[model samples]
Target: MPLAALIVITILAHSAFNGSRVTISLYALSLGASPLTVGFFISLYSALPMFLGVAAGRMIDRVGMRRPLLVSTTVLVCAVALPGLVPTLYPLYVAAACIGTSFMVFHIAVQHMVGETSTDENRRNNFGWLALGFATSNFIGPVLSGFSIDLLGHRETFLILASLAATSLFLVYRWRNQLRHTVHDKPPAAHGGAIELLRIAELRRVFICTGLLASAWDLFVFAMPIYGTSIGLSASTIGLILGSFAVATFIVRLALPWLTRHIREWTMITLTFGVALLAYTIFPFVSSVMLLAAIAFLLGLGLGATQPSVMSLMYTTAPEGRAGEAMGVRSTVLNVSHTFLPLLFGGAGSALGMGPVFWTMAGLLAVGGKIADRRRREVSAQGSG
Candidate 1:
């Protein structure tokens, strides 16, 4: 299938998954779950994905995307629907874990498919298009989730998301013949494993920077609703704040073609850290919904711009036939952020307040930017030499 088809599929699956994050968080809160418990809930989304990410990538490398894509999408449909049918906080925990793991597999497979399908000349733009699809879904997911919850209640909203996922499952099933298995046919070298992939210094830095930006991204997704609630914002308003962030992602991605021409990849990433760090630094001080959305928009621009650049860099940097595995390693790194930050920052936010959580994240961003800058200097020096 073409990249456009993959993007369409991605937008559907991702929208469902993204919407579920807000729905689950708010639903748990409605049921009297505390910030710590909410954090645990959000953390569960990353738990299985964290451990399984690398292996799933390697598996996709061997099996191709057709079966895995259908299977994962089906799993997504079931997971999203479970909460709607059960309508309980405990069932949500099960749904969260499955969504993360199954999507992790689907995500890696889709990315590999895109890279293999594209050439050097158009790779960034193709990925840019993919990111645009994600940005679109980000908007659709949360805005729809928030409104759906307010209009129909959380359970029905989940059922609505499940319907969106089911549509994705149907499309993949229909298009099974069109999907290519993979590009890299040679077996991954025996010496090559996750650890070996990480040992490459430049690719390793890409993983590090990607992880930090991902943490910032996931942090907002995980925390925005909780913070909005603490300060008396309605669910719809909280969703709007998150929605504004998605809008920013869409805008930056729209400009990616022009940006890539003038800005180098590492430069874009390091600058993103600075941008995101600023957003987080200001988040705790602001209480207005508009202001929160503006900050969210700003953070979105920063972190949003990073995904295409990071994916482009990873694909270009990987040793042949190993791009899927490389992506898997990157996924592992990202899931670590997904899994650890919620629990860590969730506990921190619960005990010390959201201000500490925001500021602490700012500290991590500062470190991430410093590392990226150092790596950029190394790359520049190598080019000159």
Candidate 2:
């Protein structure tokens, strides 16, 4: 019942967070911000998270999930509500920063709960369900926000997001007692920290792959709005394009348990990145919204599978009593890319064109995948030896 409740909580929270994400770029543009400024807004969303993610993760490990979860959800209500009240470019930046920081708190806590509650036999499937919750919310959030913006305009759409966030807070508060408290049998060794975790070669490989996959997804969210606008797509059309990607993600996540049974995780990761390379390469050339949606769906299918697999690997690889810290480390790496890549892409989009930005991201993912595969082979050969 607790796990089920967690899923429900995640769906609402993720829906609110993603709804903000899918709209923020367009909002920035609407308020007279350029591509470069939009990048700043996107990067600002991760700046606080990038710096404080590990500390936040450690806090979860030290205290428990319930408190942080409550706090973050409460923060989200204010965060999503801010832009609606002010409705300006500066307020959007404040909204981005708050949303990013608050979500990081909420996410690391939930991941810790999921890891602590599940065992080896059921971990993969359990995480799959969590991923599905995220996918479902992703589908709902963008589409709902898109339609809301078309009908209600931007300010009122943000109101809807705040309402969803408020719903998440209420659910967590109601179920607070049902969520179990996990006490580590022994304290984690103080010496190692995130640095020591990085020393394990297999874990390192997982981080690299996960980071690349995460950044690709982030770039897609940021780029799609600008790309859609460039080709004269409506706000509603852009929402559908992004929402279709989420829908594809939802379908893939539903099949993940079965996919895990038949396909090795690394193999799946490699294939997904390969498909994404093709998707991004073709993204800039397509002008029709339908074609863009089709490509986005394909990209979503690949991107969605990578998460459960990589997250399971991270939890499995983490040192005892330190899963939260490891999850934070994962969040930190992703946020670092989230922090910088958008700024770089924004500048590139302004100077060169969106074409170069897409190709550059594809090339990075391709190279990262090859490195991951090579590292896996080396690890395998050593195990046999």
Candidate 3:
């Protein structure tokens, strides 16, 4: 049931995310909005998710996953469907916000579910599989959406996404009874307030590390395509580069179970961050499309490795029976980074050009790695005691 839910959700969510920029940006362009307005609309999508993520997490704990999942998926289907009907910038922005809200709800609920279902013995593997599922969707969604849009146009593409989301909703409904049973059968444990959750030392370190790394991840992913275009890459070439990145990410995640057994979680986290830093530093220097694709592949491997490891660590460190809240906090911090980092990088890129922005991203990764190293040492020391 978990695997089924993960598969459907990944497909629908990725389709929405990958198709949204194309649909919304084109919609805004058609409405006579400037480049700046398009940027604002994109920023709003990320910002809305960050703003609602923690609240969504709390709501998931307060209620159960089924109600929120159903409601959020329903609203998202409507949001996707509405844009095709109205075709205006205001309505498009509203739809984007709704999509963001739905994503936040779905994200929190799913992570909580994954964390709750797996034992410590298999937690990392479970997360690795989840990451692989998401990466696969990320790989497939944009390419499919682009092709569909070319054949059917943007409005039609959105309607297709709406249909996919509805299919996901139906899957969730099928598993509804099982989901409630899982939630009810779990032993009672502390349901900490947000502050109390934050007070767990290991969990706090995980949050900080996850947030900082995610900020760098978002900055690179958001900025890279625009940067590539500025250097004369075709739209299709840019898509291929990003798509290759996703492919590499999926590949690395498939190997994570093996990798995690051989390397300490902290060591893997540090190594992935270092690789990411190197990729960002070298990103602006590459001009050839082939070379850029190579760098993107390396970047994807690093970025992909970091997330599941962090999630696994957080799940293990979380107080017993509070995995839901811990996973919720992890998702919240990640969503927060997703919200702001792009806007920050976009502004920086606008002011100083792509080269400088890439350099800035490298610096951020370096800083994040240093912090993670310190936190890992602290965790190790605490465990030893």
Candidate 4:
């Protein structure tokens, strides 16, 4: 298949998989799991990816994207399907883990392919388009999931997601040959372990900022449904709130080329953090659904730009032949944050209620915003000098 077709099908499958993220939390709650337990449940989604990311990256470098893509889609089918079949709390945990692991593998391979295909000239532009695909899915998934739950109920929704995953499987198999690169590029000279990639100061900074931004995204996904429920919002209403975030993300991604030309990338990262801090700080104070929707949209504008920025920086900063490894390392950091933030905040929320949880994230984002700002200034001064 052409890259365009691959992107389209992948977006469809990804949207399907993402839809489950919100519904699973609500389903788990219905099964009598506590907020803390739900935290652990959400953590399961990242735990496997947290550890396997680097290895998966290395594997893609050695072999190719085809096998990993096929395997991941297959696993995705099982992950979403099993929940519909079992319809229990334990299976939801298993499903979350499966979805996380499979998607991580699939995502790493797809990103590696994008990096491999791009030359230095259009790399950032390519990543911008890629981020658009992701933003579109993020918007489609949660809103669809929300409405499905409200209309069809939870179990039925899972089955629909499974079918979506299956479509991805079909696309991958059909395009398996095209997915492999025919020509190989020279590997980076250092050619050390994955850890060696971190030695590059710029890559290190990218990882740090990526982790912070990615974690904030995770927090909203994991916490918002719970918070919305507490505030008496229906599943569809909660989905609309989250969907609003996706819409803003889509808009930002569309404007990214212009934004990149004007604002510095590092400055954009810093701005996102500050914006997120403000939004999270106000989250607890807002009672109206429209107010919450507005906040979510603002958060989306802040968070959506981070992915393309971080991925482009990582690809450029990575040593030759190590783009996949760098992608993996970034994945590991994000998953680690994803895995821990929920567990920590879930426990905190259980004890202190959701207000403290959002406040804590706001505090963390404030610190990250400062660090990003400092880095941006130092880069600007160095360039001017």
The prediction achieving the highest TM-score against the true structure is 3
> Candidate 1's error at 58, in angstroms?
0.6
Question: Order of candidates by TM-score, top first?
Answer: 3, 1, 2, 4
Q: Please, what is the whole-model Cα lDDT of each candidate in the order they appear? A: 0.87, 0.86, 0.76, 0.84
lDDT for residue 359 in candidate 2, whole number 0-100: 95
Q: For residues 1-385, write the lDDT of model 2, one tens digit per residue.
A: 3788899989999999989986888788888889888867777778999989988877787787888999999999999989899887788888999999999999999987887788877777788889999888877887889899999999898989999999999999998887767755455656477798899776888888878888899899889998899889999899899888888998999998888777666777888888899999999889988899999999999999877778788888887777788889899998998888777787899999899999998999889879766755765687799
lDDT of 1 at 53: 83
Off by over 4 Å in 4: 22-40, 85-94, 146-156, 180-192, 222-240, 281-291, 350-359, 382-385
lDDT of 3 by residue, 88-183 (tens): 678887887888778778777777777677777777777777887787777666667778877988788888878878887887777777775234
- Report the C-alpha lDDT of model 1 over 126-243, residue by residue, as the tens digit: 8888988988997889889989999999989999999999999888888898898764457755755888988998788899888888888989988999899999999989978987
- In model 1, the clashing pairs are none
The residue-by-residue lDDT of candidate 4 on 71-156, one tens digit each, is 99899999988888998888887899989999999999888887778767666667777888887887778778889999999999
RMSD of each: 3.1, 3.4, 3.0, 3.4
Quick one: best lDDT, which candidate?
Answer: 1
Q: What is the lDDT of candidate 2?
A: 0.86
**Which 10-residue window in model 2 sums to the lowest lDDT?**
182-191
**How do the predictions measure up, each by TM-score?**
0.87, 0.85, 0.89, 0.84
Clashing pairs in 3: none
TM-score of structure candidate 4: 0.84
Candidate 1, poorest ten consecutive residues by summed lDDT? 183-192
- Output the worst ten-in-a-row residue range by lDDT, candidate 4: 180-189
